[model samples]
Structures are given as C-alpha cells and as structure tokens.
Target: MSTDTNTVTALPMRPVVADVLREAADADPRLVVLGADGQALAAGVRERYPERYIDVGIAEANLVGVASGLARAGRRVVVCAMAPFLVRRAAEQIRNDVANPGLDVTFVGVGGGLSYGTLGPTHHCPEDLGFFSALPHTRVYCPADVVDAAWAVRQALAVPGPAYVRLGARADRVVHAPDERFDAGTGLLMRPPGRALAVAAGAGVGIALDAADRLAGPGHTLGVLALTAVTPFPQERVRELAAGVDAVVVVEEHLASSGLGAATALALAGQWHGAFAAHSVHTGYPPIGDREELLAHYRITAGDVAASVLDAVRGPGAGARR
Candidate 1:
C-alpha cells in the first residue's frame, strides 16, 4: 500500500513552544523559560521577554535545578532541552527537585524518539515516555501537530506538578483542524466510527491517518484515534473508543516495551477481549539513518500499520499485498 500525501498544513512542532510561551508569558508575569542547549525552543518568547528567559548552557541537571528553584519562588517555569539529555542526564534532579515536591515545572523535550535522525542512538530518546510515566506527579504528552503542541504547552503550564511534552525535529502534518477542542487524556477521533480502530500518538498519528485512507476502498472501515497524553493513561476513553471495534492496533515511534503500545495494552487488559496489535520501534539501538529511512526500517510506516491492522481484523493473508 502506498502512502497518500497529506493535504493538511504542516506545522513546525518545536517553534510552537515559542509562540505559546510568548502568549502565556504576556499574561502571567511569573512565567520563565529555561533553555539547555535548546535556543530554538525559546525563539519567540526569548525575543520579547528576554528577562524571563534564561539559557543554562548544556548543563541538563543544572537546568532542572534552576527551573525548580524558580518554581519554588512562585514562578511558572518551563525548561526546554533535547529529550535524551533532559530525561536521562537530569533524571536524578528531575526526580528529587521537580517531581518529588510536585513543583509546577513543564519540560519541553524536542527531537523525541528517532527524530534526531543520523544523530545516532546517543541522541535518540525512545525511553522518555516510560521514565516520565513511572515518575510520581508527572504527566506525559506526545503532541502530533501544532495545535496539539500548543494545547499541551498551555495545559502543562496551567496545571500543577511537573509535565513532559515531546516533539519531533521537523514539522508535523496537522492532525487536528484549527481550534479543535482538545483536553488531556482524551482520544481525538480523526475518522468515523469503524469496526477496526487504529490508535496512534506523536508522528504515528499521521501515518495512521494515511493507513485509514488506504483501507477505505476495500470494505475496510478503520477508525483513527490520535492521543497526545500517555501518562495518566485514559483507560475510560480507550474503553469508550473501542466500543464495537473487533480489532485495535497501536502505532508509536517509541519502543513497544515502554511506549503507547504498553500503555494501551495495560489499559485494555481485562476490560476488552478482542484482537490487539502494537506497531512500535524495535528494542535495542536503532540503525544509523535519516528519520524516514529509520521509520521504514522499523516497519512503522503507513503501509506497515495498515498491514498489521488488516492481519489483526481479517487474519494472516489479508494484508499480504500491503
């Protein structure tokens, strides 16, 4: 099955933090943005409110510590950095300083998963979702588009406690219409109700949408569910969305062992008894390659997702061609 070109607008996911932060900072004087080797993440806001923005260099642990201190001083703090360093290097500080006391600090992690492309395994952050989900008083978000990215930032800043929002390196195809009503832990329906459901998060949502289109003409009605929130997993919403679907497939860019695939399976464990499949990145270090090449290599493309759904819903040989 060939992937169809998405006609929707592609929004720059990383720059969205600057736009949302600028707006949020204008209203709240207590807001501060911290960057750890991530100047691009604070583009717009840093220009307007230079005083409110601080570049902490490449020290990831120090970045979290400073943000936590600011939050303790009655200020809204947001730390922007690369996912791997932010989640891995600063794990101790994040757990002890930010998450432990339940401080209101929102961490924006760009170049999530394999988005760093040829940057290799050292930069890849497929384990971020698992780390954040396991932390107490921490929320996780993997926005698929600009709208969802903005909403995630706003929601993260508005709520209490620490939060993580993951973003890819390049632009993302718009998954939601402009100004679509979205809330945390709720799956957004991208297609009409169908017997087969395709649930995806982050970049996988766009691939899932294309897969749904590919399965349309062959008497296959596949419903697409786009989820931005991972931690605080929406068990009730998954149960509601999987109402009549005979089979469900989860697609994600992260590892199958710790990402959305695991979260969805844990949610639907005993509640729903039906065919289920998860298409995610394989365990171990990914081969060095560009983003598109890595995605195809891992078999997480539109064709791969469509084929898996077909096999789950219609048995083994149904998706042979795909």
Candidate 2:
C-alpha cells in the first residue's frame, strides 16, 4: 500500500475482472472466457465479446474440460464461476487436465470464502487454497481489490502454466495505489514498520488494516503485510518482514489449517523465533449467515484481529526474544 492519498480508489472486483478479460480478448484473439451459467457477474465481457464467451450452464466439470481443451489448442482461457463449484466440483478436471498438463488456463473463482454465506456450506469455499495449492505446476492468487485483481488477470494471461484467482462477490475498499506494481511470489507492506506485524490475504487485508487502526487507539502500532499471491508463497519476503517484529499475526477468511496462516507459519519455520497468532475460519463448516455475521462468528473481525495481536505481543507466553 502507498502512503500517497491521491492514488487509491475503491471499486468492485467483478467489473474489473470483466473489463480486464474483455480488453485482453480484444487485444488477443487467443484469449477466451468460459462460464458455468454465471454470466450475470461477467455481463460486461459477454455483452462486448459474445463470440469469445461460452456459458457451460452449471456444468463445472465440463466447463474446466472445455477451457483446458481450448488452452491445449493454443488459446488462453479464463474460467469464471463461484469458488465452491469451480474448485471443488471440478477438482479432477483442474488437477488432471489443467495443472498436470501445464495448460494456459486461468480459473477465476468468484464469491471466495464466505461471500456466498447465505447459500450454506455447499456454496461457501474455504478449501480452494488447500486443494489448488496442493497440485503441482499451479499458481494461486487472492487479490485485495480491483487494482490487484486486474494485475492478477494480466499475469494469468501471460503465465505459461495453470493459475487460480480467487475473488469476492462485492467491492473491496482500496488499500493499494492504482499504479502499485504487482508480481507473483511477493508481498506488500500496507502500513509503516511497527513492533508487531499482521499478515493477511484477500479480503482480510482490509480487515487487518482496520484492526491496525483500532490498535493505534490503544497506543499500539501494528504493521500489516498483505499477500496477493498464495501459491509459490513468498517465503523470503515473509522472513524479511517477520524480522524485528515482536510478534506476527496472520488473518484470513479461509481455514487456518490451509490458508495464509499455515503458509506464513511454514515460511517462517526455523527462521523467525517470535510469538505468532493465527486468526482465520476454524476447521469446521460455518453456520449460514450473511458475510458480516459469518465473519463475526469465526472471530475474523477487526476487533478480534487486534485482540489477537495484543495477546501475541503481551500475553503470558509472549516472553521470548525476537
């Protein structure tokens, strides 16, 4: 995140995705968009480049197959659908057809995490990172806002192998500048350096930012590290940021076991000998509610994040040296 106040603007990620794909289609005939009857969200691309868009009508498995086939035929395909179905229902196709063969396929999973909260567990997706990252030759990204999402879309178009871009259903508050540089396998520092560092991904970046502000009210300053890319986890960057911090707290919407928390812990293993706390959705199915309710239920709110950081910094067990 840049300190320059005039550079950032909040916007919805859905239209940003549509605009990026449509522009890519216009520039390159090789680019194609595929959907699983989810054209409502991608109406921009469908209306502009109808010939390049394909609606698979709720068939997630068939959708991946068609995208993979097109990629194999020298086409860059972008598969758009809800995260739960796109990643879970079409797991085999993604693993065997796209990742295994190293196809130029980009799976854009919308409504990531509890964005589809009212639809129940079947519609919620918190395991995409776990499953997708486990596969070989695949790249995974969860952008914080429209700017990062656009950059990710462009990167996916140029990358040689398979990639997954997880997005939320609603708009996100801007945290980075429009001109912020994005690269795979890298992390961004959203706030100034502090005694404690909070690592977050996707929507959680905003949450962590809010938590940092809340902590400031109590005479505490916490730094925030935003991770736009999940797979090919930025280990070196994590270590570099973790250095000099009294404690590190990782917050995410996904389950702690396989989400950014797990990735950060793995990255700092044997290197960062400091207190750590993980704030994320637990390892069980969450109760059905709206996004806010579910986030509160899982204690993924800004207040909870601030409390966790406070605990990690001054708790009974936080007596170790950095």
Candidate 3:
C-alpha cells in the first residue's frame, strides 16, 4: 500500500523477481533457490545467492523432489524451472511427493500459459491452475503482473504448506496493490462502485482494467483478482463483493472448466448471494492452438470479457446483443 492508487511506478530493478528473492533470502536464512541450470530466472537467482542457490541441472522432477526434501528438513525451498517442464514434466513428483502428501514445497512456475505462447503445445503450462486447484491442501498463485508476481513469491514463502506460483514469460504492466487486496486469496477492486463488474485472474486483470478504462460509466466496475494464493479462498470477501455487483464475468488464461469460472461457481454455490445471474459464459478452451488464437477463439480478450459483462446486464436476448 505504499504506492498511490493512480500512480504507476516501475520497480527500481529491471527484473523484479530478483529483488523478491533477495528480500526473502534476507528475511529467512533457511530460504533456498532450487533451480534447473537452463533457466534465465534461475541463473539470475544463482548468481546473487550462490550459497543458498542449487542448480540441479535438467531434472524437473528432481527440482521439485529436492524442494520437497528441503521443506521436510525444515528449509524453505523455491523450485524455479520452465513452466511446462516443471509442472507437466514433474507431475508425479509434484502430485505424489508434495501435493498428495501435503508437503511444504513451493513450485515457482516460470513462463506459464501463453507466456510461452509461441513455444508450442509442449511448452505451454495452462493447466497449472487446474493442477494445483484440485490438489488437497495445495495453494495456487497466479499473479496479475510483476509486482504481484513478487508478492506471490513472498506469500508462498510465508505459507508452511505446498504452493504453486505461475508467472508470465516477460514483464506485464503493473496492477496497483495498495492495501490488503494483494494479500493471499483476496482480489483487488480496480474500478469502484459500479453496477456491472468484470472479474479477472492472473494477467487477465490487465485486460479487465483496460476494458474498464474504455467503458466509461458510473455503473461499470472492474474487479481484478491477483489470486496470489487459492484454496483457502477469500470466501467471505468475495461473497460480500460479488453480492452487490450487477453483472459478474470471470476471466482467466486457462481452460474455463478448471480455472477462474469453476472457482467462482463454487464460491457462489456456497451462497455467494450475488447480483449476477446464474447463467454465464466462461472463457473456455478446448482446441489446441496458440494463446492468441485460443483467447480470440474463446473470446477472452479485454473487449470480449467486457462485452460479456454488458451482455449479462442486458440478458440473453437484449437489444445490445452482438
């Protein structure tokens, strides 16, 4: 909350995650960077925290396994590796070794989802959210931008259990986190006091914010959620906020079923008591294609997410229907 609401400032450093790691290392001596040698992000952490950083070469499973072991031995380990390789390649180690048994490991998933959009299907880690969401006692973090990405790392480090953090390949425009909105599971309401709302998860927050900027009105709101950690969702807060909004549209960069929409449905089913209608259109994905194609194909862009909000307000067959 140190920064002002409207003032957007860049991090003092170029790559902000480095500062985050350094801060965590300073905060706790037991913090270790468990990384694969090939990762640029991992290499950066290794250069600075040589003593506390371990480069385990190319073993994604070993990357997570070592972290689980470290956590068991009372050390806090951040397993940094390629997004898809770390999550998909190390599925068994993550599921069985950490998530299933509820081990205290944090997988720092780099280049998640379309961040590696051009890297092909094999490199995409869109399922990380779905993977962690279903796991028992597992927490998930999908940061909106670099600031929240760094904050997410801190949040996971503080937790004494398994956490998954998925970050984009490169820096994203900063999303303001003035107060407790940046806290674990809590979401930030970017636009204040509006009848209609667009809910966003991860980088989709930026898209929602952009749409809100263009859609000027007294009754239009943009509710962006960083979701630095999920599982112990900000249920009471979400329920309270969702109840008052006229229209609610959920957005995420993952498959619709297991991502933001699913979580929002569960939150509502547990008596959300929201103004939004029961029927809604999700940012769905089933076709195997590039991220842009996937988002456009699924109508998940800022304009599309925004259009859905207006559609929800007008109903199934309103004059404004497109």
**Best-performing candidate as measured by lDDT:** 1
Q: Model 3 segments beyond 4 Å from truth? A: 1-14, 43-45, 177-181, 218-226, 270-294, 316-322
Backbone clashes in model 3, listed as residue pairs: none
> How would the candidate models be sorted by TM-score, starting from the highest?
1, 2, 3
Off by over 4 Å in 2: 1-10, 217-220
**Candidate 1 deviant stretches above 4 angstroms:** 1-3, 6-8, 316-322
Ranking according to lDDT, highest score first: 1, 2, 3
- Cα distance off (Å), candidate 2, residue 272: 1.8
> Candidate 1, after superposition: displacement of residue 74 in Å?
1.5
Q: Cα lDDT of model 3 overall? A: 0.67
lDDT of 3 by residue, 1-322 (tens): 2122255444321266666777777787888888787545555556667888888989888888887888788887778887788877788888888888777677777777666665666776667888887888888888867667777777887877888888777555566653434656456666653655565777666666766765666555555544555556676766667666656677667765777767777777757433442122243434666656655655667777667667655565332312
What TM-score would candidate 3 get against the native?
0.83
Question: What's each prediction's TM-score?
Answer: 0.93, 0.92, 0.83
Q: Could you give candidate 1's per-residue lDDT for residues 81-140 as a string of tens digits?
A: 999899999999999999989999999998888888898888888888888887889999
Candidate 1 worst ten-residue window by lDDT:
313-322
Candidate 2, poorest ten consecutive residues by summed lDDT: 1-10
